[model samples]
Target: MTNSAPDVPATPEQLRRSIADRTWTSPTAGILDGYQQANLVVVPASAATEFAEYCRANPSVCPLLASSAPGDPQLTYDGCIVDVRTMVPRYRVWQNGRLAEEPFDLTPRWREDSVAFALGCSHTLDGPLRRAGIPVAVTAPPVYITSLTTRGTTRFDGAVAVSMRPVEDDLVDTAIAVTAMLPTGHGAPVHIGDPAEIGLADLASPDFGVFPGIGPNQTPVFWNCGVTPQLALAEAGLEYAATHYPGHMLVLDTVVAA
Candidate 1:
């Protein structure tokens, strides 16, 4: 059974509309349940092949979803016509290794050779956990950073950053069982102990989002997050690329075709 939270709408149309209009540019993690969410990377076609190769070499971290052919904003192969320019809640456009706040659209800087890539995301795991009666704690969406360094595919290099969730110790096993079946969702826990073990010096200070302390005896489990790709982008110093603002995913009807 899937989770049936009252606030989780039967359809994500409302949420998607809000995002497209730029009215709701916040995180989309908990707004919709069961739907697949993806991280995005839109870059020039000059880098698409190498990036595709990189994705192939590193499937656990950067699981690819859909991609539009060159110059196409329509991700139609998956029948999900995301407006690459505005469908996402927010965009992070980078130039020559520096990061900017958020770009509502990439019209001005849209590369003629640009292509987009979607990666599988961790939010896909939360639904089943909630249904299983596992207590998955979150102030909103758990934006987290992993302490492990991803095996970089060339210029991409950085520690994997993951969202944190406080799982009750007893439900940890069930949560693992539930998530393992979703192979595209980074599989299962990458680490399950003190944040310090993953080089996370403290739980209070995450690379993103608010961090509430782990409850008494609750365990901190980590996963091979999709944000791994964004970190890789940041590390590579790619002159032109855009990623969805962390936690602000593309809630698509398309499942992870991986």
Candidate 2:
């Protein structure tokens, strides 16, 4: 369920401070318009190299933006200072391939051998899709795990994750065109029409976020999602791993150029 809180943060800095202050512990969707958002992933030094390669092998789903040196909580998005420990609204701690806790901060869990990665989110292209007359809503898009699996890297293996957006039939082409312009943002629709063709059994029941309905004359569009890495981490079963809670993401100072 979406947070029902009033006065949602409106600017990138305001949203970052709200998260840092622990005042808003909800998904970052619909928060700062135009600025890019990212999926967060922190892993131990031992698993960092393999994970980085995993991202490279699966660029469409995990377009890496920046990565930090081991033991560093500071990310490398030039021109902006972002503290990975607390700038994201919510974080999911993982242990032995399972979710351990959803915390507002990761200071207690940071490790000297930890390395953080910032991956581009499809949300970065929502503005262009909207301006192009495709109604890409700001609310969380429904994500589903497909039978498809990544070309397994050293220790990473799992099904692919795809987020779905229902587009009016007439605008589906426009949605594809606009989203394709942003290569870093999971460019283009991987699947356009049937959910079953992609192994999505039901639309109402999703692996993450609220299920969006497919209205008459609308088709459900699917895109590779940054959440794909979370699945790989689970399969890798590292002693410890951390990621942004699905839907909750790190708001960035960068913008997706039109």
TM-score of 1: 0.87
C-alpha TM-score for every candidate: 0.87, 0.95
Overall lDDT per candidate, in order of appearance: 0.71, 0.86
lDDT of 1 by residue, 1-258 (tens): 122223433566666665666566666666565777787888778778878877877777777777878888766425666776776777888876678657665566567778988887788777767878976543344446655776666676677777677788888888778877775566677777777777887778777767767888788777777667777777676778888877667787744332
Model 2 stretches astray by more than 4 angstroms: 1-6
In candidate 2, the residue pairs with backbone N, CA or C atoms under 3 Å apart (3 or more residues apart, or in different chains) clash, namely none
Measured with C-alpha atoms, the lDDT of residue 15 in candidate 2 is 82
What tens-digit string does per-residue lDDT give for candidate 2 at 1-258?
235454876678888888888877877666665888899999999999998898889888888989999999999785777889999878899999998998879999999999999998988877777777777778889899997888786788688999999999988888888888887778998899988888878889999888878899999999999788898888887999999988889988887775
Least lDDT summed over 10 consecutive residues: which range in candidate 1?
1-10
